[model samples]
Target: MGLLDNLKARLAPAKGKVSHLAHEHGHKVTHGLDRAAKAVDEKTKGKYSDRIHTGTDKAKGAVDRLAHKDEPPAGGGDTFTPPRTPPPAS
Candidate 1:
């Protein structure tokens, strides 16, 4: 087996544990993130509010993804439809 495959095999249990924990405590994790972001933003007097908001959003998204990694995609299937564009003016 390749080194990467060996590593993955070893870490599979840990990944499962993490995924379970994330799913179980995702709400608390996200709440903590929001609380911490508020404290930091308050300390910085809102100077970094925008950046802080962005970071917090990304962290929450990561947590959400981890928590839902095993779930099937919504909408029943993977069918996708592209938006139609208007015709260009002559």
Candidate 2:
């Protein structure tokens, strides 16, 4: 096997463990992130509110994505739907 493939194979179990932990502790992680962000923002006297909020949002999104990595995508299996047009008023 190639070096990269070997590395991936070795790390597969670790990745699974991480995914499981993230799924189980996702809510607590999110709550901790919120609390940390609030504390940091307060310490900085809101000078970095926008950046803090953005970072917190990205971190939460990452956690959510990781926690749901094994789940199928919403609307099911790579399906796409085009937006429907509204009917004109009579």
Candidate 3:
């Protein structure tokens, strides 16, 4: 295999382990993210509150994605449809 392929092969196991850990300790990870964000915001005296909030949200999203990587998609993979569409009113 090429260099890139070999690297991917080796890292596959580590990636699986990380996904598992993220799933198991996802709550702790999210809590830590919040705590760190709060500390930084306090240190900056709220000057970067917006940016810090955005970063914290993104980090939490990433953690959730990793933790649920193996789960089925939201809505159970079903296409959504609007309910009770009004009949054509002439």
Candidate 4:
């Protein structure tokens, strides 16, 4: 096996543990992220509020993915459909 494969093999066992921990403490993790973001925003005087919000959202998403809570529904209709917009009258 190549370097990446070997590394993945070694880390395979830890994946389950990480997922379990994330599932158990996901709310606490999210609360901590919010608290940290609020502190940073206060320190920055709201200068980077937008960027901080974005980063916080991405972090939360990562946590959800780690906890496997982002999985698609078991019903299997996972496709996305764009909303239709009506054309303006000429």
CA deviation > 4 Å runs, candidate 2:
1-3, 73-90
Per-residue C-alpha lDDT of model 2 across residues 14-33, encoded as one tens digit per residue: 98788789999999999999
Per-residue C-alpha lDDT of model 3 across residues 4-84, encoded as one tens digit per residue: 999999999998788889999999999999999999999999999999999999998898888886467887676777778
Number of residue pairs clashing in candidate 2, backbone atoms closer than 3 angstroms, sequence gap of 3 or more or interchain: 0
Candidate 2, overall lDDT?
Answer: 0.91
TM-score of model 1 vs. true structure: 0.73
Sorting all predicted structures by lDDT, with the top scorer first, yields 4, 1, 2, 3
lDDT of each: 0.91, 0.91, 0.90, 0.95
Clashes of each: 0, 0, 0, 0
lDDT of 2 at 41: 99
For model 1, residues 46-88, the per-residue Cα lDDT tens digits are 9999999999999999998888854677885668776699768
Report residue 89 deviation for candidate 1 (angstroms): 36
* Residue 38's lDDT in candidate 1: 100
Q: Over the stretch 1-90, how does candidate 4's per-residue lDDT look in tens digits?
A: 999999999999999999999989999999999999999999999999999999999999999999999888787768876769876789
- Candidate closest to the true structure, highest TM-score: 4
In model 3, the number of clashes is 0
TM-scores of all models? Answer: 0.73, 0.71, 0.75, 0.79
Residue pairs that clash (backbone atoms under 3 angstroms), model 2? none
Which residue pairs clash in candidate 3? none
